[model samples]
Target: MAASLKMSDDKQETEIEEGANTSTNASPRPSCLTPDRQALADSIMESVKASVSKLRRGDPPTIYIVPQIIRRVKEVAYEPRMVSIGPYHNGKERLQGMEENKLLYLHSFLSRNPDHRLVDYLEAIEELKDKARSCYSEKVGPLMGNEFVKMMVLDACFIVEILLRFYPRCRKMKLVKQQREELEQNEEDLGLISAMKKFLFHSNGFEDPILSTIGMVYLLGCDMLLLENQIPFFLLQHIFKMACPVKVPHLLEKMALDFFESRSMPWNEKIEMNDSYYHLLHLFHSHLLLTPTNSKEEPNLSCIPKFKLKPNLSCIPKIKPVLNKLKNLLPCSNKAPLLNTKRRRMIPHATDLQLAGFKFKKNEKSNNILNVKFSHGVLEITPFLIGDNSETLFRNLIAFEQCRLKAKFHVFTTYLVFMDCLVNTSKDVALLHHNGIIDNLPGSDDDVTHLFNRLCIGIFHNFKGSYLSDVKDNVQKHCENKWNKWRASLKRDYFTNPWSFISLMAASILLLLTITQTFFTVFPYYRPRSQFLIIMF
Candidate 1:
């Protein structure tokens, strides 16, 4: 009976152990925790759920702070200097001075149209507040309801006032000599001329702070074009239309173009205005891609005449083909590959391309600065002006292109990369400058070279099927031509100067005379006197 009791006890212990093992293998149960820990976990879950609910569904963020990697290179280039337009740099002590100016602009905007009260503008911005908030990449917290609405109203009014003040000035400055004369003579332009004169005379004094000093105006313009310092275009348009007595379609864009226009870096006036621009910077970026009226016409390669050797060099024609054939037989390791690949193909630098008989020309035929074309041994690039503001303008444009989600073309980025490939050193800059392709107004060739080289740092783009790929490939193929290189070598080495040409000619004449004299001298010795005389006769 004691043995049976011991066996039953062992069986019960095994069953208890098996039940524990089965429980462990099943899904885990919630652990008993302290009240504080449980509260913390519940708070985190609630916060996550709230954040998930607040997430934007289909609306993509347009305005963004410049990426840290890109901004770290030139931090000041991305930051607003004179004024802050959007909430990104709002209320900073350095930029606070401009806030009073914004209010002053608001007062002036209200003064333009007394019929529309301040409440009307406030209500308008209130309606756009949610849409405007969605435009920014980050939630504009700390600025809610009336605060955000008030900020947008002030900023929008400030821009509209500035544009209104700058419109007449822009018209006066952009007119050519003939256009100005026509404006003076034509009855139609009388009202426009009068307005220009009035603004010009009035703006001569310091009545307005922003427009009085040219330097302040320039700095403010730069600040306005920053990627982070932007308000919505619709907001500006709404405020402008309400403030102005006359409702003119696209007058805001015209005034904006005029306000942004710089004599040092003029833009093509034939830009197409689009309603889809997120902000002023985007509008300006689009303007940089000028539409060519005659884009259907292919680049006239024959317009630039080919380099020709003097016809007097009779032996050159006969020997060139042989030299070219020999050169072709040699392998070219440095030549750019023709295959389309993900990697960006960098063409030879300006000096190197020049050495290979490639000529650089300013492409005045097209206003589109990105229209780089290579044909018939000529590489044509549109004239680009580098000024004090060039870096700020280009950097912001690049940052916008890099950051914006729907920006697939990357036109400015590709242009900069293309320029970077061409300009590796100061010598390259000098070459482009000499060719009238680059107008360096700000600094030396080294500075321009450094600007291009640095602008493309930390920027990424797949260059396989980019706009400049064909031009790049064509340039590479041109450089790889053996005949062109040989011709360039001959011209550079033998005919670089008049002295070298004279020496080559003298040597050639001496060699011919020597061979003739030797042939005549040997004929008298090898043949009989009568036979030699008969041959001479």
Candidate 2:
């Protein structure tokens, strides 16, 4: 999970670094996450501790205690005695330190022991799903309002990853059980797929929930191989199916493609290769490479039939009711948390830092490698500061990943990872965090770097989501271009295939027999070789 979060959160950090910490000398390459930064983080933690202490002793407990309580939850190993005393079995009201500790212990037992079998990450996600369902059923139900919805959304988002990646066997089992229980009911509770659509389309009123859930969903759905920085195995298999003489629905593929295409901030030019490369290539190939010397006219585009598609026969009706239910239940819509496209803004250099490649300038050497692979790693944005020389500009430290990758390789889906060396918190470089990493970087000293670090590693850490769009347009085109070239070569005659080679041999033998019979009948004196051999035998 942390592996997936780094590229995004680091971008959030780059924006604020210039104002983050100005001790006069942020020079050369700035010291990363220093002792000074740690000290500031400690002070912020102390303030939180103090605030929590005051709340625990207050006349009535505060409302926003969960995020803080989550920060301090006792993570104990579970024992048989404690299993009987499970906090989840009762209620959140009865959640004491020991019970929290015991639950943590159970989590650790199920999750961390090396001696135990390797339970899948998807199953781990499902375990989280079960806990989330409890919130909706017996415990803090919707009666508790958005708080209930918020926790469910957060946990659901985490599991969204599992569904997208693992496609758990239990998911099928759960659906069977649900259908059996509902019998005549119209809804199937979405089976995880619905949870995602709800967030992308529903969770608008939420300040933070909408950003992570929708974003992650679209990101994962795009293509796991590119996002995860791994090449797709059996690439030919997928390409053959997509490019087969068989037809595919244009609208469905368009929706899927458009979602992958949406991740860029508007300023970036739609890479000409996007839909153009294939479109142009086909046109160019017909006009130049495969044109008849006898014909002077252009090929008609309409000669090829348009692709028509039908939505999943099984899902069409299922999705309809689910969509309507989400609308009736949530009744809200909000704008996406995307940056403005029109206003052209460049990240200015910081106080003393030097970023090697700043926003695809003339001197750009390599693209930054910020994808799902680094989601768990620390994403620090050391900027080109207030004063820097040409030597510093020439010195390459941070690399950028210019292409949008689809995580289709090993992870569930794909999203783009855009790594700008000179990103700002509010201005230039951006820093981001894993879902839970934010708590480690509190800003007690109120220094900008201190605050930035906290925000990256510790604040609203690790909010996973579902995203269909990707930011790395270059990578997608690269992947797609490669797919097209491979597909173009697949238009060989059937006999070229080993399987068809045998069929061709059989057909040839049949044709030879037919020709010999015709020849014998046309010229009666002519006896075929087969007839002479048969008489001799």
Local distance difference test scores for all models: 0.73, 0.27
lDDT of 2 by residue, 1-537 (tens): 875686655554443343334422344334676767756755665555544444444322101111322223211211111111111222334333333433332333223222232233233333444323322112333324444333333222222222222333454345445544554434554333343232122312323321247644443332221211111111212222222222222322232223333322111121122222111112111121111111112223333344456655342334445445444543122432112222332212221011211122111221211112111111222112211111111110000011111222211111111222122343222222212111222232123332222221211211133221222222122223322223322322222357555654655565556556554444434667777568658
Cα displacement (angstroms), candidate 2, residue 279, comes to 19
Residue 353 miss distance in model 1 (angstroms) = 1.2
* Model 2: per-residue Cα lDDT at residue 508: 56
- Model 1 C-alpha lDDT per residue in residues 508-537, reported as the tens digit of each score: 675566556656766676799999989879
Model 2 RMSD in angstroms = 32.6
After TM-score superposition, the amount by which residue 467's alpha carbon in candidate 2 deviates from its true location, in angstroms, is 30
| TM-score, every prediction | 0.71, 0.17
Cα error of candidate 2 at position 510, Å: 99
> How much is 488 displaced in model 1, in angstroms?
5.3
